[model samples]
Target chain A: MPREVRERQMLDAAVATFARHGYRAASMDGIAELAGVSKPLVYLYLNSKEDLFTACIRREAAALVRAVRHGVDPATPPDRQLWEGLGAFFTHTAEHPDGWAVLHNQARTSGEPFAREVATMRADLVAFVTELIAAAAREAHDDPELGDREVAGLAHALVGAAESLAGWADTDGSVTAKEAASTLMNFAWAGLGNLMEGERWTPR
Target chain B: MPREVRERQMLDAAVATFARHGYRAASMDGIAELAGVSKPLVYLYLNSKEDLFTACIRREAAALVRAVRHGVDPATPPDRQLWEGLGAFFTHTAEHPDGWAVLHNQARTSGEPFAREVATMRADLVAFVTELIAAAAREAHDDPELGDREVAGLAHALVGAAESLAGWADTDGSVTAKEAASTLMNFAWAGLGNLMEGERWTPR
Candidate 1:
């Protein structure tokens, strides 16, 4: 394989290993072995274990954010947009279970730098949720009752519910993405609207 | 300290240390020193790190279950019962942050036997939510309308929301138990009622 292709293969192997064994437990030799290369060659491509892990975090985080962002269309009804965003999330998590595990489980446990990388991704995702709520509010102008606290709390609940549901859906091998999205919509949108009795949204 | 007092102290220290450092990262030596006991003494009472971790899981899991069970008054309205159950969950997670970390984060990540122990605790909580939904349906008097899959999905969403909120509230460091309870009540009760609309609690 070409160097770039070889490097990508090594990273893929590293992510899968990191996802299963966690950062502390995953060894560089094991990763190199999994990639069908020597440990020195793996180092030549990725430099070190820390660098390799960081690369994995950045790749996975960016992919997840990109997928969710791409899944949404700002022009659509906010409810529909939220559903698409959630669909994107569930799909990414399912398709890249190892990558998702690395980002969610291993990255956090890796401590310090790795934790910060995932934290940034979380904040980004949280902001996306905040915007979705604002859009929903704008689309359904009923009252001035929805305050920052309520919006923030609702966003937290929605995002958290999505994360939790992703893990749950993964465990029950039979569940589909459409089913997961619908469940979250029922659990979130109706309650949010009732709470928002009166809130207006405008362009940023 | 006497052996009984020393044992309790060791267990408390173990729970705190394990909560902070996780099962794999936490050292028995560190726990012993923190408890003001000798290493052999910790070994005397706890036997090994695995047993020590398991003991912590069992104790904290039982405490959490007891808190929720004790918090709800059986005579109250089903809404109130669910409200109280949620309140208990928030309170337990808040007051026992270390134990919460162990049960929610550590044990769940450790895999297999440890995971199963915590899984049992989670199953209890899920069953409680399932039963609560059934009772809500029974009280409402209309046909439940929801299939087993739908109810199970809702239960998972609710449980995940509760767990997520617990972690979020802790991270923010300012949300009190009452505020957390109200946040959840606002987010959940209305959404829950929407499902049971034909039965009892109208969406309005």
Candidate 2:
């Protein structure tokens, strides 16, 4: 097989191994065996355990970003766009559970290098959501302007909630991707809409 | 020192060690040294590493639950109760950053035993939030009632959002516990109140 094909196979095996055994316990030998390649070849291709883990993080993060970006249509309204993006996110995570595990569970907990990689992906997604929220606010005529910090906070909350819901959906096989997305939309978008309208919930 | 005092000291040291180095890399020897006790004494008091870790988890979880429970007053309205509870949570986490890290980052990422301990605490908090949401819904008299699963979803979202904000607040010192709780209340409670009033945000 070609080098590219071989590299992909190694990464697939690496993600599976890392997701199952975690970052510390996962071995190059185990990854190589799972990849059906020699240990030397695994080392030759990926270089080291850290490098292999980083490679897996980058690949999974990119795939996730691509899925969300593809699912969203620029022409659609802000709510529709968010809905579509969330649906794609749930579908992609469900289909690639191991990849999701690597990005969400393993990478963040491993160490600085891996955690930073996942954090970068998260920052990008948070920025995207922030833009959508600002756009939604703009669409609502005469709505009060949201400060940058508030927007960032809302984006972080929404992303965190989506991630939590994704884990819940993954654990319970009966819950569909669409259902998860809808639940988040109702839980979040309605709130965002209310915030945009200056309908604040004050302490009694 | 008495046995109870020594045990408390050991758990505090264990939490710091586990939070900084993670579970697999963290050693009982390091924990003993940090606690200013001998290895044999540490082992004698806490038994094995597993039990020691479990003890740390239970202590931290209980402390957290106690803080929230103490902060909320039953006589106050649901919104005030949630606000007070969140304030207590943020204060407790900020004060015990290491313990918070152990529960939020380390414990969950560790194996089944530790994760389940943290999960039990999480379930309790989620249940508490669910009851608050149900109360808020009831307050908005004659409005549409949210299904049980919907309330559960909302509770999870709120808890996840709170966790995310806690981490953010810990990283940035300028953000106080009160500020974090208020931001979450504004971001979440508003939407929840709207939902209870049958004000849903739909895709256009």
Candidate 3:
């Protein structure tokens, strides 16, 4: 087989292996065996375990950012943009469960280097959400009434909400991406605008 | 020290060590050393690493649940209840950073018996949020609008938001518990009733 094809195959195997066994637990030998390659060749393509794991993080992080960035329409209103953004996230996570695991579960758990690597991805998502909230306020109040600290907090909450729902949908494979996204939208966007009037829900 | 105080000290040491090094990586010897006790004595109190970790989870989980439950008043509106619950969560997480790490970071990553153990605490929190969201809906619509599945999803969002923000606050030590709670409230509770209006924040 070609080296490029073999490299892709190795990455596929590495993502799966890393997802299941985390960084420290997963050895290059195991990954190479899974990839149908010799350990030496695996080393040839990916240097050390640290580099290989870094490669895995980079690959998964890039894919996620690309998917979410490309999925949503920039021209749409903030709400629709968020809806599309979440849909993209759910779809990507479902399609690439191993990649999501590598980024979310494994990367941070592995330690500082990898955590910082994934933190960049997380910060990207947070920045996206922050900008969205600021823009919404601009369109809503026609001025940035929300303070810097408040906006930062809002961005964190939004990202957290998305992350929470992602894990939820990940475990419950029966739930569709669109369905999960819409459910989150209702949960988050439904009760918003306390300044307008309290649209609170109550139990029967 | 008294037996209870000594046991608490050992448990605290174990949790801090485990949170730092992870369940698999953490050692009883290190825990004992940190507790300023001999290894044999550490075992005398907590028994084994597994037992020690479980004890940590139980302690942290109970404390977290109690804090959140204590913060919310059943008689108050669901919105206020959620806000107060968030405040308690932020405060507990901030005060007991090591305990929070054990429950939030280490417990989830450790897998198996530990994960299942923390899952119980998590489920309780989710249930509370689920009922609160349902109650909020019923109070608003005067009927049951949000279904069981939907409520579950919303609860997950709320919990995830809280968990995410908790980690955020822990890492960004400059941000206080009160600020974190307010951030979550704004991000989650704001403009929720605008389901018809369809408002959302997205990257501009």
Q: Output the number of the TM-score-best candidate.
A: 2
Q: lDDT tens digits, residues A96-195, model 3?
A: 9999999988887666688899989999999987787667667767555676666677667768878878888888888878878887766565444342
Q: Give per-residue lDDT, candidate 1, residue B66.
A: 93
For candidate 2, write residues B1-204 as lDDT tens digits. Answer: 799998888888999999999898998889999999999998899889999989989999999999998999978887788889999999999999999999998888776778899989998998988888887777776564787778878888888888888887877777788878877888887777767878776777
C-alpha lDDT (0 to 100) for residue A123 of candidate 2? 88
Count of backbone collisions in candidate 3: 22
Query: Residue by residue across A82-165, what tens digits does model 1's lDDT show?
Result: 778888998889899999999877787565688789879988998899888876775566554666666776777777778767
**lDDT for position B143 in model 1:** 68
Q: Residue-pair clashes per candidate, as listed?
A: 3, 0, 22
Docking quality class, candidate 1: acceptable
How large is the C-alpha RMSD of every model relative to the true structure? 4.7, 2.7, 3.7
- Listing candidates in order, what is each one's chain A TM-score? 0.90, 0.95, 0.89
- In the range A1-204, model 2's lDDT, one tens digit per residue, is 999999999999999999998899898889999999999999999999999999999999999999999999988988899999999999999999999999988888776778899989998888898898888887775654677677777888888888888887777787788888887888787778778887767775
**lDDT per residue as tens, model 3, B110-170:** 7667878988999899998888877777777755556678778878988988888898899
Angstrom error at residue A131, model 1: 2.3
Q: Which RMSD does model 1 reach against the true structure?
A: 4.7
Highest DockQ among the candidates is held by which one?
Answer: 2
Error of 1 at A55 (Å): 1.8
